[model samples]
Target: MRNFEVNGINCVNCANSIKNALSDEFGEIVVDLEKNPRVVSLNIDDKDLQKFTDELDDLGFKLIREI
Candidate 1:
């Protein structure tokens, strides 16, 4: 699994949107706006990381840190 901190998420709708967007591309994605340090976590192969990050970048969201 990977943990990515997302900034500029302002509302629940945005959270849900991100969750849905990521879900379409990855499986076992768990987006939590309610977390202390709001994060988007997912279980995906390493080969897909760059593509997913690119997709997130295209959405205008910064992928802060990957853990």
Candidate 2:
């Protein structure tokens, strides 16, 4: 799983919004709300990483870094 620490995920609703918005194209998305910056994890090819992050940005999530 590729995990990305991101901002703008304040609550469960935000997490769900991310999952709902990207899951279909990006596959299952796991958001860890317990973390300080929050985490969004999913399986994706390296070639698609940029696209994935871009999509997240389009949905109002900003990537801090990938883990």
Number of the top TM-score candidate: 2
Off by over 4 Å in 2: none
Per-prediction TM-score: 0.79, 0.94
lDDT of 1 by residue, 7-47 (tens): 76767887777777878778766777786456888887879
- Which segments of model 1 are wrong by more than 4 Å? none
Q: By lDDT, who's the top model here? A: 2
lDDT of each: 0.77, 0.91
Question: Which lDDT tens digits does candidate 2 get at residues 1-67?
Answer: 9888999999999999988888999899999999989988899999989998898899898999987
lDDT (0-100) at residue 64 of candidate 2? 91
For residue 20, give model 1's deviation from the true position in Å: 2.0
